[model samples]
Target: MNVHTPALAKAHRFDEPTSVFARDVIHDLSRAPKRLSPKYFYDATGSELFEQITVLPEYYPTRTELSILRNRSRAISSIVPDGAALVEFGAGSTTKVRLLLGECRLGAYVPVDISGEFLNAQAQALRADYPGLAIHPVTADFTAAFELPEAVRDMPKVGFFPGSTLGNFEPGEACKFLKSARTILGKGARMVIGVDLEKDERTLYDAYNDTAGVTARFNLNVLHRINRELGGDFDVGAFIHRAVYNRDRHRIEMHLISKKALTAEVLGQKFSFRPGESIHTENSYKYSIDRFALLARVSGWSLLQSWTDEAGLFSVHALEASD
Candidate 1:
C-alpha cells in the first residue's frame, strides 16, 4: 500500500505486525455465544461504510456532536494551553478535529488509530491543509499502550476523544480507558471528550438501525474482512445484521444473526452456528451528563465543563486531569 506522508508529517507504528485478527476470530467463534471485536470493523471498506453511516438521517450522534463542537469551539479552546500537542485517540475521520485545528493554536497534532493506511492518508491531507502545523500520525490501537511522537514529548498534551466512542466500552472498560488516557496525556493535561446522552429508546434504536441499510453493511464488513485477510469462508449473505437497544444494560448491542445452520472455516479451523445463533459484534453505551461526570471524576479527571445540544441528544465535555 502506498501511504503518502509529507516531509512535515511522519507516521509511527508502536506494535509489530501480527495475525491478531485470525487468533481472536478463531477463539471468539468457538465461544458459546460467538463474538467479534468492533476494532476489526475498520478495514478500508468498513471505514468507508462507517463514514456513510455517520451521514444517515437517523444517525444523530455525528451531526449533533459536530454542532456541539462548533458552537463551543471557543470555550473548548480556552481550556487548551497554547502550544499544547493535541493527541486524539482513535482518530477516525478528520471532520471533527478540523474544528479544533482551526480554533486552537496547537504546536502539533497527533492522530492515533489502528488503521495505518487510512491514518497515513488522512495525515498527508492534514499536512497539506495546515502546512504550518506539525502532523504526526501513529498507527496503533489507542486502547493499548503506545508512545507519543518524540517531537511532542516535552510539549504539553491535550487529549481529544470525540464521537461518543467511550460508549463503545462497558462501564468498567470506560473507566480503565479514561485512566489510561490520563496516564498517556500526563500532568496538567486537559481532555475534550464527546459522550452520547441517554435519551428516548426509539431515538437510540433508530440511530443504529437506519433505513438505508448502510449501518448493516458496516456491521457485516467484519466478516468480509475475515474472508479477505484471514482466508475465511463465511457466507456473508447467510448472516444478517442486527442492532437492538439493551435497556437494562443502557447500551445498543450489534449482532450478526445466522440465517440458518451453517459452518464457517477460518485459518483451517471450522465453527458451526445454530439456525438462530448470533455473533455479538459491538456495544454502544449512552450516558446522562451527570452519570458521565461521575464516571470521569472516578477515572482521574475532574469534569471542567459539559455542553449539550438544544434537544439534549448528544454532549461534549472538557476535563482536567486531577491531582
Candidate 2:
C-alpha cells in the first residue's frame, strides 16, 4: 500500500510557535539515541496506517474493547441520564464507536483529532450513517484540555476514549489529561477510557514490532515524512523498527534503529546516526489496576467500574469525578 507524505511546505503558512517547536524537537530527536514524542506519530498517513494495524490478528485491543462496549453499551448509556453528547478523543476510524452509538442513545456526536482532513472525512461519514446524530468535528490536539467547538458548548457530555490509546501518554501526563477533561466537562460528565493491563513482555513486543513488517514501515515512515516535509535526507532503508517492554516504566517503546551509519539533513541542518542507535518513536504504557487507580485519584477522577477480558490482557474503565 502506498502511503502519501503530506508536503508541509505550506505548513509554514499556518505556522505556530508550538508547531515550529515540535518540528525542531522532532528533528533533533531523529538523530541517534533521540526520542520522538508519541503525539508526532499521527500525521494523516500514520493515522490511517494505525487504523489498519488495529484490525490485524496480532492486535487484540480493538476486538476486546469493542466487545466490552457492545456488552455494556446499554448499561453505560443509562449513566447519560438527560441525553449526553458523545465525544471521542482520538476517534480514528471510529469503528467501535458505531456499536456504542447504535446501542446507546446519544444527543449528539463530536470527534476531536489533530488531523483535520481525516477528522472531517470521518465526521462526514458518521453523519451519513447516523443521520439523527448531530456531528461536530473539532480539529485540535485534545491530548491537553482543549475548548469544545461552539456547537457542543451547551451539551452534557459523555467522553468515549476507547482503544488503550490512553497508554501512549506517560502516567503524569495521562493524569493531567484526565483532570483537564474534567475541568472542560464540569461535574456531570462521564468517561470510558481503555487501559491495557500489564501483560507478558512477549505479547507486548509482538504487538508493537509486528512480524508482518507493517509496524516497521510505520516507524520509518516518519523519516519519509520528514524527508518530504522538512527537506530532510533520511535513508528509510537504513532504519529498522524496534519495540521492547520497559518493566519499570510499565510501557512498551517503539524505536527506529539505524541499520548502518547514515546522515540526514533537515531544515538546513544535518544529523548523523550510528548503526543500532535508535530514535524513540512512541511508548504504550501498561498499567496494573492499583497503579491505575492512583493515577485516576491524582487526576480527580474516581474509578466507577472496570471491565476485563477473560485473560485480563486489557481493561475498559468507567470513570467519573467523586462528588
Q: What is the TM-score of each candidate against the true structure?
A: 0.94, 0.91
lDDT string, candidate 1, 280-314, tens digits: 99999989898999999999999999899999999
* Top lDDT model: 1
lDDT of 2 by residue, 1-323 (tens): 00111234234452553345336555556544687766656777888888878877788788887787787777766666455788888778878788777777677788888777889988898888888888888877788668876777788888888888778887778888888888877777888888899988888877886777777777777787777655667888888888888998888888888889888765544677888888887888898988888898888888888878788888888888766
The whole-model C-alpha lDDT of candidate 1 against the native structure comes to 0.88
Clashes per candidate (backbone, < 3 Å): 0, 0
lDDT of model 2 at residue 29?
Answer: 69
In model 1, what lDDT does residue 247 have? 91
Assess each prediction's global lDDT (C-alpha) against the native. 0.88, 0.77
Which ranges of candidate 2 are over 4 A from the true structure? 1-14, 21-32
